[model samples]
Target: MIGNMEIFLIILAALILFGPDRLPKIARELGRAIREFRNSLEEDLAG
Candidate 1:
């Protein structure tokens, strides 16, 4: 299980790697990928 410190470290690392300029774009793409994955799972379950 990850704690708050772990989450913070991950975010810090991401900031260092991607920088502030591209973080929002990366986050938006990640969110869309997750949303699409969930939608596909729901469709599979319902069908």
Candidate 2:
């Protein structure tokens, strides 16, 4: 399980690597992709 310190370090690394301004947009797109992927998997399983 990831602890608070690990989460903070990951966020800090992302901020440094991607720049703070682009992080939110990146996160949003990542979330949408994950959601769509999960939905497709669920549909496949259901069918």
Candidate 3:
């Protein structure tokens, strides 16, 4: 499990890099992109 300090650092870095307004949207898009990539890999493996 990730420690609280590590999580806090990650959040801080994200805030610094993305700012408050864009962070949530970027996170959501990144999550979606990762999910889609995983799904595509699974489909390829299945076929």
TM-score of each: 0.89, 0.88, 0.80
Name model 1 segments beyond 4 Å from true. none
Order by TM-score, highest first: 1, 2, 3
Q: What is the C-alpha lDDT of each candidate?
A: 0.98, 0.99, 0.98
Across residues 1-47, which tens digit of lDDT does each residue of candidate 2 receive? 99999999999999999998999999999999999999999999999
Model 3 misplacement above 4 A: 1-3
Q: Write the per-residue lDDT of candidate 3 for residues 1-47, one digit (tens) a residue.
A: 99999999999999999999999999999999999999999999999
Per-residue lDDT for 1-47 in model 1, tens only?
A: 99999999999999999999999999999999999999999999999
Q: How many clashes would you count in candidate 3? A: 0
Cα miss at 34, model 2 (Å)?
0.5
Let me know the TM-score candidate 1 reaches against the reference structure: 0.89
Q: Tell me which residue pairs clash in candidate 2.
A: none
lDDT, residue 46, candidate 3 = 100
Ten-residue region with minimum lDDT total, candidate 2: 11-20
Deviation in angstroms for 43 in model 2? Answer: 0.3
